[model samples]
Target: MTRDLKALLASDQTALGTWTQMVAPELVDLIGLNGFRFTIIDCQHGPFGIETAENLARAADANDIAVALRVSRNDPVEIMKALDAGIRHVVVPNIETAEEAETAVAATRFGPHGLRGACPCCRSGGHFIRNWDSYVTAEEARTGAIALVETEEGRRNIEAICATSGLAALMIGPFDLSVSMGLNGDWRCDEVQRAVTEMARAGTSAGLPVIMPVFAPTPAECRDLVDHWRGEDVTTFVVGSDKILIAEAFASWAAKLS
Candidate 1:
């Protein structure tokens, strides 16, 4: 089952997770076994497609960890495909307006409330074994969408975007936002910090969990950033990524040998 990270965050719990660009299902199992509550499959920047996402979703379920997909863009087709592949939690990136927010949310839902196409036989629906009523009910409870605010325009419309209904959370994309604002990816810039604070506050006020990435190079720095954001009511975080961790470990081993 998807771990229901949305519900966990709504309960005011701090959920920390990592990102994975590797196309291996076993990698997701490892992340879960290591005690992470969730993992985000970086489909947008990574080489993940629908098939790979399906396998990763299964791995996450087996390990009782929520698997979130960061779609390449805020496209309904891509979002719908991920959902059908059993990715219950989705992070749509580059959302710059309320309409984009609405579109992303709608793609996660079925008709009447959304525009998702029906696929009872899809993995998300249990391959048609589960009754329609039971399946729809469970799907409603499990699936959720998180909009990523990564650009200056997104920051400007943060309030309206957060106000969109059916959003489970908001993700502050620090690096992209900084670059978009002409800071050249300097997320530590005072202006970037201000924008991040405003966005996080808006999402919190809208009753949505706000997720921010802690991209520090050391554990101490990561803790510092987490503590700072915890005071801002942004409890959910992506502490790091599998790629960075692997590279860091390899570098540490080489340094020790040298």
Candidate 2:
């Protein structure tokens, strides 16, 4: 169902997702329809306006896929816009402290619980055809706010960050984290591995699960990676993106043609 992602996350069950870097709604639908439990609409690097993002969100939901938006910034407007577009999950990047995590959560809710502006006519409120306040209350209950603990500073403070009340999960930004630790993009380096392990431990201690990313160059490699994380006790992971899938397929085609 559309609530599958939330249910899985809430139950501490394994939730699998895929990245959507392109603005194409068709790709979003296909990603969800392909059996992924969730999809992250990457707004940070993907050029999409509120309308386009909303269209994509609707597409994913129509296929019974939960949608999350990795907003461009932790700014309240960016977060609000994402939710207003009917996305139930919001991922804020580069969160290094509890205060930042709180802010991310605050941006997703109304007053008392949060500071999100309320509008009855928006997609979030069902276009003013229903009770606005009731809609806000219900939507917040279904929402998940995830914090990206990417940098060295962020990883060091991960426990406290995860301790934020409304923050749902800690998402590892592998590339940025590798660069932050001076690993020079060596995600496989021993030092980088240690950092990853420590970060996961911190989240575990805080009573939160870490959202890991599974990246691979081939389908078999992807399966192996998922199995490895499952053995490592990773309850949630996102598969590689539409971009990576196309790249892999194209590379294989070029090799065969050669």
Candidate 3:
């Protein structure tokens, strides 16, 4: 499969994606088919079993949506498992140092940088076919490894992390970053805004795209951010999470009933 992610980001296209907590295969398939450019199978906080993850990956593939898995940690086992299940893109959360970023790159690969045990039975390895070598090579070329920088320390180390050769992008996890900076959920605080802006500049200077997850906000607010960033032409935005949508909907309904 052609990796359109890099191209999409490069072209300054508005690629819409969602973060899913519902990891069921059917739901994943439905979301993908509904025109989501990509859907993240959130393994970090979402309830997703290995088998279900595999099924969801397959469904996303079938529906022509890119499957990116958000691993809870920067563990090699979790990274390899997600890759084995045919997830080509990975978002590793809370990467605070150059060492962590290096470790993440290693985990995503097969030999040099990582200790990933190759399994021919895995979907990514072509089920151990005679063409396994070709499969691995091609897969390696298309795979994306994103580092989520969500801390004051991570912000400080942004340049080093962006300089890492294999890193595809630097993702800003605003919530965690806000808390880390003692903003305590005040994402609009001057300190938080400055940090995010500097991080974006660093990533762009290093020739890496910056990705930001836009949480629950009015459509106008979302558009304003998108327009601003899109004008810069170096960042990709993933619209709000499914969990937030569900909560908002329920809260609105409760208000109506009352």
Q: lDDT: which candidate is best?
A: 1
Residues 1-258 of candidate 1 have per-residue lDDT tens digits of 577776667756778888988988887888889878888988888886878877888888899987899999888889888888888889999999999999999998888888888876887766774577777777877888899999999999999999998888999999999999999989988999998999999999988889989888777889999999999888888987888777877888899999
List where candidate 1 sits over 4 angstroms from the true fold: none
Best by TM-score: 1
Enumerate residue pairs that collide in model 1.
none
lDDT of 1 at 230: 91
Q: Per-residue lDDT for 23-56 in model 2, tens only?
A: 7888887776777888888888777766777888
Cα lDDT for residue 121, candidate 3: 88
Q: State the TM-score for model 2.
A: 0.93
Off by over 4 Å in 2: 11-13
Q: In order, what is each prediction's RMSD in angstroms? A: 1.4, 1.9, 2.3
- TM-scores for all candidates: the values are 0.95, 0.93, 0.90
Record all residue pairs in model 3 with backbone atoms less than 3 Å apart, i.e. clashing: none
Residue pairs in candidate 2 whose N, alpha carbon or C atoms collide under 3 angstroms: 110-114
Kindly provide the TM-score of model 1 when superposed on the true structure, using C-alpha atoms. 0.95
**lDDT comparing candidate 2 with the true structure:** 0.80
The clash count for each model shown is 0, 1, 0
